[model samples]
Target: MTIILAWYRDLIELTMSSNLMTMVQPGAFSNLIQIGVLNLRLNNLTTIKSDSNSITNIQSGAILNLPKMRELNLQSNQITDIRPGTFSNLPNLPRLRLSSNHITNIWPGAFSSLPQLRWLDMCSNQLTYIQADAFSNLPQLSYLNLASNQIATIPPDTFLDLPQLMKLVLLNNPWQCDCRMVAFSLSSAEMLTNTIK
Candidate 1:
């Protein structure tokens, strides 16, 4: 994936690097803080290495920098999990794209840092399990795309704090819309109805 992919026409530091850890580090992207956007989409970023040289599947502390970063593009990768505080430093980040990955699980408090985030695209993944209130930190989130996944059921109170949520795309999933999901169905219907207005 190409890091520091800016929003304008010109790209920065275009390279074919495979290892996500060795990207101008052990400095850890300290020079990319001035850029407005970063597009690391479409690559073989399979693992992210911690400061102590420990190997892991999720890229957390490795990307905690970039205070001015607004949009981040990580679409189409091999990420299967999201640990907590992976993005705690980027509080101003608004849009995050994570579509078409292999993410099956997102730990609780994983996105607690994104308070100003607006759009989150987690569509077309292998997500089957998400902890309750996993998205509680996103107080200003508007659009959420969870379409085309293995989601069989969404636990109640999952989206309780998302009052400003505009669109929720849950199409093409194996939803067990039974009585146990009364609250989920009702809230989803209400969210949609509110969106129409």
Candidate 2:
């Protein structure tokens, strides 16, 4: 469905949760220049791009023209894949919630555009593996939650890009107790120690 918010030029927050929306046409929020918070939780959104059929594959310019966007909530959806440049349009977004979705894979550069993001929640998803650069380019990201997923192991440098990351939650996952896990544990401890200093 097309969401024409042209009349609400000065709108700051818009919540379209539980709307059962399957698709959102491009330029849906083009006129909401002052918008900061957008909540699209509990929807049937398979793809953020009108031309795509995959879940959560947000192509560039799909939801563009929101220069002031800060918080975006897409929880409890059928999102499975987080393609690269998904949030390229929301440059100023800080907090993103993708919990309780069907997310299985996070491609490289998926969050490359969100330079100012601080908080990210991906709990209760189907994430099994994450690329090393999936969370790259987010220099300001500090908090990350990956609880209740099917992840078994992660790349050693999976979080190497997040220099400011302070909190990382990975509870309820099938983590393997191998050398990789040992390395990750040591690195994480070091990062936390630095953050505390």
Candidate 3:
């Protein structure tokens, strides 16, 4: 952990060659020099601790301020609600993975600031709703995965803005499978598949 702190303090890429880090000390790497990519996959991080080393609440700015950051991996955590502005500062981030977490709701504008974003994985979570225009500004987004979530109803024209989107995975969501949902499914590429309830 000390080495990880030293490397991170130098604005270096933090790669996880192993999944053994179960405890994270806060105030560890919030002010690292200029990191570009942060990969903390397969770790045991439950809550992203604050910068005070006192196990404080997760602060969105901790990861957002890494200016050169292009990719962030928080997969397989216990994260639930994603507060607004959590991703507002990651302008250069392109790939974000939050798969297999405990996420429930994605508030409005939760992902509106990512212009270069392409691949986003929020699959296998506890999400049940998607607000209108929740993904309006993601013009460059190509792949999105909302599979295995608890989603029930998806509004009309929910994906009208994602024209270039190629792969959309809605499998395992307990949809109502009504006429409106049927039409919404039609707009998606044939490559996109949804499980029927």
Number of the top-ranking candidate, with TM-score as the measure: 2
Q: Local distance difference test, per candidate?
A: 0.70, 0.82, 0.68
Task: State how far residue 104 of model 2 sits from its true place (Å).
Answer: 0.5
Q: Give me candidate 3's TM-score against the actual structure.
A: 0.76
C-alpha lDDT of residue 74 in model 1: 66
Please give the range of 10 consecutive residues that has the lowest summed lDDT in model 1.
Answer: 48-57
Model 2 alpha-carbon miss at residue 74, Å: 0.6
Q: Return the candidate ranking by TM-score, descending.
A: 2, 1, 3
lDDT of 3 by residue, 5-40 (tens): 644456657665236554344445556647777776
The parts of candidate 3 lying over 4 Å away from their true place are: 1-9, 16-30, 43-46, 49-58, 180-183, 186-197
Tens-digit per-residue lDDT, 15-69, candidate 2: 8888777666677777789999988888877877632222355556677767799
RMSD of each: 5.0, 2.4, 5.4
Query: In candidate 1, residue 123 scores what lDDT?
Result: 95
Q: What is the TM-score of each candidate against the true structure?
A: 0.80, 0.91, 0.76
Residue-wise C-alpha lDDT for candidate 1, range 92-178, written one tens digit per residue: 989998888788898998889899999999999999866786797898999989999999888776876787787788899998878
